[model samples]
Structure formats: structure tokens, C-alpha cells
Target: MIETVIVVLHLLVAIGLVGLVLMQQGKGAETGASFGSGASGTVFGSQGSGTFLSRVTAILATTFFLTSLGLAYYASHKASAVQEAGLPDPALQVEQVAPAPVLSEDVPVIEEDVTPVPAGEDVPPAAE
Candidate 1:
């Protein structure tokens, strides 16, 4: 559930980053133009969109990068909801097992001996 939320946030951040990047002015637009032409001194405007937009873009980029790392961490650590789960590994898996007893073809094992009693007499306990 947390992973899903992070994925959604990551996608939103990526889209925001792309939009911000596209909206910003590219190289050789306004800053260098005012330097080459002395008609105007346009280092920064009253609204200062260049600095503000760039700062926002940088923030979005960082967020996107962090979300990407989070997704990678989740993908590497979490297991799938299937029988044969995410990557074949030992900590997540062991062997398939069943409760089976081993049998051998050699002579059968006996724990105690059995002896026949005398025909019809009550036998007294033998002195040990």
C-alpha cells in the first residue's frame, strides 16, 4: 500500500518536473540578450519569474529523484504476491517440503521382544 502511494507520487512529480522544465526559458533568451544590447538592463524583473520558476523546477527535480530511489528500494526489497515470488533468493525462500518418513529395505527394526505365555497358568513375576 505504501509502495503504491509512492509510485503515484513519483509519477506526479515526474509530470510536474517535465512541465516546469518546458515552461522555463532556455539558453540565450533574456539574461544574455540585455548584456549584448545596452537598450535595457534586464538582469532580474520585478516579478522575478526566472529565479522563482527555476527554484521550483529544482525542487521538483529533487523530489522526482527521491521518489525514484524510493521505488527502486521497494522493488528490490519487497516480494510478489505469487507462488514463485519476486527474484529467486534464500532469505525469502526455502525448499518445498512434505511430512514423509524414510523407509529402508534392510531388516525391520523392533523396539521390544514378545514371548508366548504358558498354556493356562498365571505366571508369577520373575525376580529381576
Candidate 2:
């Protein structure tokens, strides 16, 4: 549930950033080159300050950065509750890799010989 909420928040922030950027006019827009007004007022009213759109863009951009960082943090952290339910500890999993089979160091392995005999020759003595 937390993962889903984070995913949704991340997506919303991404979309908001895209929208905010698109809504702002470009540098070459005609709002600056018209009716005796220089490129100053059209941009920041000659005070060199950002406009409402600029402020909104900044806020959304910050949200985007924060949400991105949050998603990354959440991704790296495993949920302890989920991991503790009948699940093997990740650390011990590798250690428990079935200790290599221990062979008897003192015993020598011997192979038995198997032979087939001719069918008719001696009807190997019958039990009396």
C-alpha cells in the first residue's frame, strides 16, 4: 500500500512538472518584443524577479526532486514485516547453502567386480 501511494505520488509530480514547463512561455515569445516594451517587463517586470508562473514552476520542480528521492529511498528499503513472515533471513540464506557434503576422510572407496558366466556349463551344484 505504501509502495502504491509513492508510485502514484511520483507519477503525479512528474506530470505536474511536464505541465508546468509546457505552460510557461519560451524566451523568444512575442510578449517581450511588443509596443515599446523591452524584454524586461514581459519576463519579470524589470525587477529581475520571477513571476507567478516561475514560482509555481519552482515549487513543482522541488516537489519532483523530493518525490524522486523518496521513491528511491523506498525502493532500497525492504519491508521488515513482509520479510519476517516465514521468510529466510537474506543474510543467513547464503550461509546456509547446504554445507558441502562431508566425505569420510579415512575410508577408501572400492569398486566390486561383476562377471557373467556361460549358461550351460555347471548348473552350479544344487543344494542337497
Candidate 3:
């Protein structure tokens, strides 16, 4: 349930962020003739600053970042819901794997003697 709530919040915040970004007026909205073309500074307006849309965009951006972090945390730390309720802890199960087969040091092994013979000697013929 908590995970679902977090996911919903993440989606809502993402949509809100997109809307706020799109609503903002892009740069270079002015630079055309300024009615008389004297020196109309501060392109937004005579007030020389941003408006509510910019502020809302900033707020939505922060919220989106927080929600992203929250969702990441929720995904990483979530427990496996499929585990049976009455089962023993998984930490103990490793001891129950069958032990690997053991080989005794006394077992005999056939080994070829690869020592180099004298350079000119031919190899002995195989016994029939």
C-alpha cells in the first residue's frame, strides 16, 4: 500500500513538473521592436523579474527530485512479499545444501613422464 501511494505521488509530481515547465515562457520572447525602441530593459516586464509560473516551476522541480529519490529508496529496500509467513529465516538455509563430495589423498592416478629424452634418440615403439 505504501509503495502504491509512493508510485502515485511520483506520477502526479512528474505530470505537474511537465505542465509547469511547458507553461513557462521561453527565453527570447522579446528582442523585437519595443514600441519606441529606447531602452526597455528586463525582458520579462517593467517589474524586472519572473512571475508565478517561474516560481511554480521551481517548486515542482524540487518536488519531482524528491519523489524520484523516494521511489528509488522504496524500490531498493522493499522486502520480498512472496516469502511464506511461517518459513524459517533464509540465513539458515545455506547450512542445509549437501556437502561437496570428498576425494581421498590415497587415490591412485596414472601420470605420463614428460621428461625430455636425449635430442637424437627416437621414441621407443609401443608394446603390443
Angstrom error at residue 68, model 3: 0.9
lDDT per residue, candidate 2, 39-120, as tens digits?
5654566433336778888887888788788877775566564476767756666554667877797888787664566887
Per-residue lDDT, model 1, residue 33, is 54
Which one is best on TM-score?
Answer: 1
Name the regions of candidate 1 deviating beyond 4 angstroms.
31-48, 79-128
Clashing pairs in 2: none
lDDT of 1 by residue, 1-128 (tens): 99999999999999998898888786657665556555244455533357888999989989989999999888775544332564465566777999797777786987765576898988768768
Model 3 lDDT per residue over 1-128, tens place: 88788789879988988877776655554344335353346565543244767787788788888878887887655433324455565655766688898878888778977767788999877668
TM-score of every candidate relative to the true structure = 0.51, 0.47, 0.47
Of 1 and 3, the candidate ranking higher by TM-score: 1
Quote the positional error of residue 52 for candidate 2 in Å.
1.2
Clash tally for model 1 = 0
Between which residue pairs do clashes occur in model 3?
none
Assess each prediction's global lDDT (C-alpha) against the native. Answer: 0.76, 0.71, 0.68
